[model samples]
Target: MSEDPSLHQSHPDIIKRLKRADGHLKSVIEMIEAGRPCLDIAQQLHAVEKAIGQAKKTLIQDHLDHCLEDVVGPLPSDRRRTIDEFKEITKYL
Candidate 1:
Protein backbone atom coordinates (compact mmCIF):
# COMPACT_ATOMS: atom_id res chain seq x y z
CA MET A 1 0.00 0.00 0.00
CA SER A 2 1.11 3.55 -0.64
CA GLU A 3 1.84 5.93 2.17
CA ASP A 4 -1.20 7.83 3.28
CA PRO A 5 -1.73 11.37 2.09
CA SER A 6 -1.64 14.32 4.42
CA LEU A 7 -4.38 13.25 6.79
CA HIS A 8 -4.54 16.94 7.61
CA GLN A 9 -6.63 17.47 4.51
CA SER A 10 -9.18 14.67 4.34
CA HIS A 11 -9.24 13.21 7.82
CA PRO A 12 -11.28 15.86 9.52
CA ASP A 13 -13.89 15.99 6.81
CA ILE A 14 -14.14 12.22 6.78
CA ILE A 15 -14.45 12.10 10.53
CA LYS A 16 -17.09 14.78 10.50
CA ARG A 17 -19.13 12.90 7.96
CA LEU A 18 -18.76 9.63 9.79
CA LYS A 19 -19.64 11.25 13.06
CA ARG A 20 -22.80 12.66 11.55
CA ALA A 21 -23.68 9.24 10.29
CA ASP A 22 -22.99 7.77 13.68
CA GLY A 23 -25.38 10.20 15.28
CA HIS A 24 -27.95 9.40 12.65
CA LEU A 25 -27.56 5.69 13.26
CA LYS A 26 -28.09 6.22 16.94
CA SER A 27 -31.29 8.05 16.13
CA VAL A 28 -32.31 5.21 13.88
CA ILE A 29 -31.93 2.79 16.76
CA GLU A 30 -34.01 5.07 18.90
CA MET A 31 -36.64 5.25 16.19
CA ILE A 32 -36.80 1.51 16.18
CA GLU A 33 -37.09 1.37 19.95
CA ALA A 34 -39.86 3.95 19.82
CA GLY A 35 -41.70 1.90 17.25
CA ARG A 36 -41.55 4.61 14.63
CA PRO A 37 -43.12 4.02 11.27
CA CYS A 38 -41.25 1.93 8.75
CA LEU A 39 -40.94 4.76 6.22
CA ASP A 40 -39.42 7.16 8.71
CA ILE A 41 -36.90 4.59 9.90
CA ALA A 42 -36.05 3.72 6.33
CA GLN A 43 -35.53 7.37 5.43
CA GLN A 44 -33.15 7.95 8.32
CA LEU A 45 -31.31 4.75 7.50
CA HIS A 46 -30.90 5.97 3.93
CA ALA A 47 -29.48 9.27 5.14
CA VAL A 48 -26.95 7.45 7.30
CA GLU A 49 -26.03 5.22 4.39
CA LYS A 50 -25.52 8.20 2.09
CA ALA A 51 -23.41 10.03 4.65
CA ILE A 52 -21.12 7.04 5.14
CA GLY A 53 -20.99 6.45 1.40
CA GLN A 54 -19.98 10.03 0.68
CA ALA A 55 -17.26 9.83 3.30
CA LYS A 56 -15.92 6.65 1.73
CA LYS A 57 -15.96 8.19 -1.75
CA THR A 58 -14.14 11.29 -0.54
CA LEU A 59 -11.45 9.24 1.22
CA ILE A 60 -10.89 6.95 -1.77
CA GLN A 61 -10.69 9.81 -4.25
CA ASP A 62 -8.33 11.73 -2.01
CA HIS A 63 -6.06 8.71 -1.64
CA LEU A 64 -6.05 8.20 -5.38
CA ASP A 65 -5.16 11.83 -6.04
CA HIS A 66 -2.53 12.15 -3.34
CA CYS A 67 -1.09 8.98 -1.80
CA LEU A 68 -1.15 7.01 -5.04
CA GLU A 69 0.44 9.89 -6.89
CA ASP A 70 3.38 9.77 -4.51
CA VAL A 71 3.85 6.05 -5.09
CA VAL A 72 3.18 5.95 -8.84
CA GLY A 73 4.66 9.37 -9.68
CA PRO A 74 4.43 10.23 -13.40
CA LEU A 75 4.48 6.70 -14.75
CA PRO A 76 1.56 6.40 -17.13
CA SER A 77 1.09 2.67 -16.63
CA ASP A 78 1.17 2.96 -12.87
CA ARG A 79 -1.28 5.86 -12.93
CA ARG A 80 -3.62 3.97 -15.21
CA ARG A 81 -3.45 0.97 -12.91
CA THR A 82 -4.28 3.06 -9.89
CA ILE A 83 -7.18 4.70 -11.67
CA ASP A 84 -8.48 1.40 -12.89
CA GLU A 85 -8.27 -0.01 -9.40
CA PHE A 86 -10.15 2.95 -8.06
CA LYS A 87 -12.83 2.64 -10.73
CA GLU A 88 -13.25 -1.04 -9.99
CA ILE A 89 -13.61 -0.45 -6.29
CA THR A 90 -16.19 2.27 -6.74
CA LYS A 91 -18.60 -0.12 -8.44
CA TYR A 92 -19.72 -1.49 -5.07
CA LEU A 93 -20.78 1.97 -3.94
Candidate 2:
Protein backbone atom coordinates (compact mmCIF):
# COMPACT_ATOMS: atom_id res chain seq x y z
CA MET A 1 0.00 0.00 0.00
CA SER A 2 1.14 3.50 -0.82
CA GLU A 3 1.51 5.96 2.04
CA ASP A 4 0.56 9.60 1.87
CA PRO A 5 3.63 11.82 2.05
CA SER A 6 1.57 14.96 2.72
CA LEU A 7 -0.41 13.22 5.42
CA HIS A 8 0.27 16.04 7.83
CA GLN A 9 -1.49 18.50 5.55
CA SER A 10 -4.02 16.52 3.57
CA HIS A 11 -4.99 13.81 5.97
CA PRO A 12 -6.87 16.11 8.33
CA ASP A 13 -8.94 17.60 5.54
CA ILE A 14 -9.64 14.16 4.09
CA ILE A 15 -10.67 12.81 7.46
CA LYS A 16 -12.98 15.75 8.03
CA ARG A 17 -14.69 15.16 4.73
CA LEU A 18 -15.04 11.47 5.45
CA LYS A 19 -16.53 12.23 8.86
CA ARG A 20 -19.10 14.47 7.26
CA ALA A 21 -19.94 11.72 4.84
CA ASP A 22 -20.23 9.24 7.68
CA GLY A 23 -22.71 11.49 9.44
CA HIS A 24 -24.71 11.91 6.27
CA LEU A 25 -24.70 8.15 5.72
CA LYS A 26 -25.99 7.59 9.22
CA SER A 27 -28.75 10.09 8.60
CA VAL A 28 -29.61 8.30 5.38
CA ILE A 29 -29.95 5.04 7.26
CA GLU A 30 -32.23 6.70 9.78
CA MET A 31 -34.27 8.26 7.00
CA ILE A 32 -34.78 4.88 5.41
CA GLU A 33 -35.73 3.26 8.69
CA ALA A 34 -38.13 6.08 9.48
CA GLY A 35 -39.77 5.81 6.05
CA ARG A 36 -38.85 9.30 4.96
CA PRO A 37 -39.76 10.65 1.56
CA CYS A 38 -37.70 9.39 -1.30
CA LEU A 39 -36.61 12.89 -2.32
CA ASP A 40 -35.16 13.73 1.08
CA ILE A 41 -33.38 10.42 1.38
CA ALA A 42 -32.04 10.81 -2.13
CA GLN A 43 -30.71 14.26 -1.35
CA GLN A 44 -28.92 13.08 1.77
CA LEU A 45 -27.51 10.14 -0.12
CA HIS A 46 -26.25 12.47 -2.82
CA ALA A 47 -24.54 14.62 -0.24
CA VAL A 48 -22.82 11.61 1.24
CA GLU A 49 -21.73 10.45 -2.20
CA LYS A 50 -20.37 13.84 -3.14
CA ALA A 51 -18.47 14.16 0.11
CA ILE A 52 -16.80 10.79 -0.37
CA GLY A 53 -16.05 11.49 -4.01
CA GLN A 54 -14.47 14.83 -3.21
CA ALA A 55 -12.33 13.25 -0.52
CA LYS A 56 -11.06 10.63 -2.92
CA LYS A 57 -10.31 13.23 -5.58
CA THR A 58 -8.52 15.44 -3.09
CA LEU A 59 -6.39 12.54 -1.87
CA ILE A 60 -5.35 11.46 -5.37
CA GLN A 61 -4.53 15.00 -6.43
CA ASP A 62 -2.64 15.67 -3.25
CA HIS A 63 -0.58 12.57 -3.81
CA LEU A 64 0.06 13.67 -7.36
CA ASP A 65 1.18 17.12 -6.26
CA HIS A 66 3.11 16.39 -3.04
CA CYS A 67 3.82 12.71 -2.69
CA LEU A 68 4.97 12.33 -6.27
CA GLU A 69 7.44 15.15 -5.85
CA ASP A 70 8.71 13.74 -2.58
CA VAL A 71 9.17 10.26 -4.01
CA VAL A 72 10.44 11.18 -7.43
CA GLY A 73 12.68 14.10 -6.45
CA PRO A 74 14.15 15.94 -9.46
CA LEU A 75 15.51 13.02 -11.43
CA PRO A 76 14.19 12.65 -15.00
CA SER A 77 14.08 8.86 -14.75
CA ASP A 78 12.16 9.06 -11.52
CA ARG A 79 9.79 11.58 -13.08
CA ARG A 80 8.86 9.08 -15.75
CA ARG A 81 8.26 6.48 -13.12
CA THR A 82 6.02 8.85 -11.22
CA ILE A 83 4.07 9.72 -14.36
CA ASP A 84 3.63 6.07 -15.20
CA GLU A 85 2.51 5.25 -11.71
CA PHE A 86 0.10 8.16 -11.73
CA LYS A 87 -1.34 7.05 -15.03
CA GLU A 88 -1.95 3.61 -13.60
CA ILE A 89 -3.63 4.99 -10.52
CA THR A 90 -5.90 7.31 -12.49
CA LYS A 91 -7.35 4.37 -14.36
CA TYR A 92 -9.35 3.47 -11.25
CA LEU A 93 -10.91 6.93 -11.09
Candidate 3:
Protein backbone atom coordinates (compact mmCIF):
# COMPACT_ATOMS: atom_id res chain seq x y z
CA MET A 1 0.00 0.00 0.00
CA SER A 2 1.10 3.58 -0.64
CA GLU A 3 0.62 6.60 1.60
CA ASP A 4 -1.39 9.87 1.61
CA PRO A 5 -3.83 10.71 -1.18
CA SER A 6 -4.46 7.07 -2.02
CA LEU A 7 -3.01 3.66 -1.47
CA HIS A 8 -1.78 1.65 -4.42
CA GLN A 9 -2.55 3.89 -7.40
CA SER A 10 -3.46 0.99 -9.68
CA HIS A 11 -5.75 -0.65 -7.12
CA PRO A 12 -8.92 0.59 -8.82
CA ASP A 13 -7.98 -0.82 -12.18
CA ILE A 14 -6.90 -4.08 -10.62
CA ILE A 15 -10.19 -4.34 -8.75
CA LYS A 16 -12.13 -3.78 -11.96
CA ARG A 17 -10.13 -6.41 -13.72
CA LEU A 18 -10.73 -8.88 -10.88
CA LYS A 19 -14.44 -8.16 -10.92
CA ARG A 20 -14.58 -8.91 -14.64
CA ALA A 21 -12.66 -12.09 -14.04
CA ASP A 22 -15.11 -13.05 -11.30
CA GLY A 23 -18.02 -12.63 -13.70
CA HIS A 24 -16.25 -14.62 -16.36
CA LEU A 25 -15.50 -17.35 -13.84
CA LYS A 26 -19.18 -17.57 -12.94
CA SER A 27 -20.04 -17.89 -16.60
CA VAL A 28 -17.51 -20.62 -16.99
CA ILE A 29 -19.16 -22.46 -14.13
CA GLU A 30 -22.51 -22.10 -15.88
CA MET A 31 -21.03 -23.40 -19.11
CA ILE A 32 -19.85 -26.47 -17.27
CA GLU A 33 -23.27 -27.03 -15.77
CA ALA A 34 -24.87 -26.68 -19.21
CA GLY A 35 -22.52 -29.23 -20.72
CA ARG A 36 -20.91 -26.76 -23.08
CA PRO A 37 -18.18 -28.21 -25.26
CA CYS A 38 -14.85 -28.63 -23.53
CA LEU A 39 -12.99 -26.62 -26.17
CA ASP A 40 -15.20 -23.56 -25.75
CA ILE A 41 -15.00 -23.75 -21.97
CA ALA A 42 -11.26 -24.11 -22.20
CA GLN A 43 -11.02 -21.01 -24.36
CA GLN A 44 -13.13 -18.99 -21.96
CA LEU A 45 -11.07 -20.25 -19.06
CA HIS A 46 -7.96 -19.15 -20.86
CA ALA A 47 -9.34 -15.64 -21.21
CA VAL A 48 -10.18 -15.51 -17.53
CA GLU A 49 -6.73 -16.76 -16.67
CA LYS A 50 -5.13 -14.04 -18.76
CA ALA A 51 -7.26 -11.36 -17.16
CA ILE A 52 -6.26 -12.51 -13.67
CA GLY A 53 -2.63 -12.68 -14.68
CA GLN A 54 -2.76 -9.12 -15.97
CA ALA A 55 -4.35 -7.92 -12.77
CA LYS A 56 -1.68 -9.62 -10.70
CA LYS A 57 1.04 -8.07 -12.82
CA THR A 58 -0.50 -4.63 -12.42
CA LEU A 59 -0.71 -5.01 -8.64
CA ILE A 60 2.84 -6.24 -8.20
CA GLN A 61 4.27 -3.59 -10.47
CA ASP A 62 2.28 -0.85 -8.77
CA HIS A 63 3.65 -1.87 -5.35
CA LEU A 64 7.15 -1.90 -6.77
CA ASP A 65 6.66 1.49 -8.43
CA HIS A 66 5.10 3.23 -5.43
CA CYS A 67 5.59 1.58 -2.05
CA LEU A 68 9.16 0.35 -2.38
CA GLU A 69 10.36 3.28 -4.46
CA ASP A 70 9.53 5.64 -1.56
CA VAL A 71 12.91 4.97 0.00
CA VAL A 72 15.76 7.45 0.02
CA GLY A 73 18.83 6.57 -2.00
CA PRO A 74 21.87 4.74 -0.53
CA LEU A 75 19.77 1.93 0.82
CA PRO A 76 21.57 -0.41 3.19
CA SER A 77 22.81 -3.63 1.57
CA ASP A 78 20.24 -5.74 3.46
CA ARG A 79 17.36 -3.53 2.38
CA ARG A 80 18.68 -3.45 -1.15
CA ARG A 81 18.88 -7.23 -1.16
CA THR A 82 15.29 -7.52 0.05
CA ILE A 83 14.05 -5.08 -2.55
CA ASP A 84 15.94 -6.93 -5.23
CA GLU A 85 14.34 -10.17 -4.10
CA PHE A 86 10.92 -8.61 -4.30
CA LYS A 87 11.62 -7.27 -7.76
CA GLU A 88 12.80 -10.67 -8.83
CA ILE A 89 9.60 -12.24 -7.57
CA THR A 90 7.49 -9.72 -9.45
CA LYS A 91 9.04 -10.93 -12.69
CA TYR A 92 6.96 -14.10 -12.29
CA LEU A 93 3.78 -12.08 -12.15
The global C-alpha lDDT for each of the candidates, from Candidate 1 onward, is 0.84, 0.83, 0.86
What local lDDT does model 3 show for residue 44? 94
Task: Compare the candidates by lDDT and give the number of the best one.
Answer: 3
For every candidate, C-alpha RMSD to the true structure in Å:
4.5, 4.9, 3.8
Off by over 4 Å in 3: 1-6, 72-92
Flag regions of model 2 displaced more than 4 Å: 1-6, 75-93
Pairs with steric clashes in candidate 3: none
Error of 2 at 80 (Å): 9.1
lDDT of 2 by residue, 1-93 (tens): 236443547778999999999999999999999999999999999999989999998888777777666766676785578687875788478
Q: Tell me each candidate's TM-score.
A: 0.76, 0.72, 0.73
Error of 1 at 78 (Å): 11
The prediction achieving the highest TM-score against the true structure is 1
Residues 1-93, model 1: lDDT tens digits: 235536737878899999999999999999999999999999999999999989988888777667766776676785688677875686566
Q: Predicted candidate 2: what Cα RMSD to the true structure? A: 4.9
Error of 2 at 34 (Å): 0.3
- Order of models, best TM-score first: 1, 3, 2
Error at 56, model 2, angstroms: 0.4
Q: Over all chains combined, what TM-score does candidate 2 have?
A: 0.72
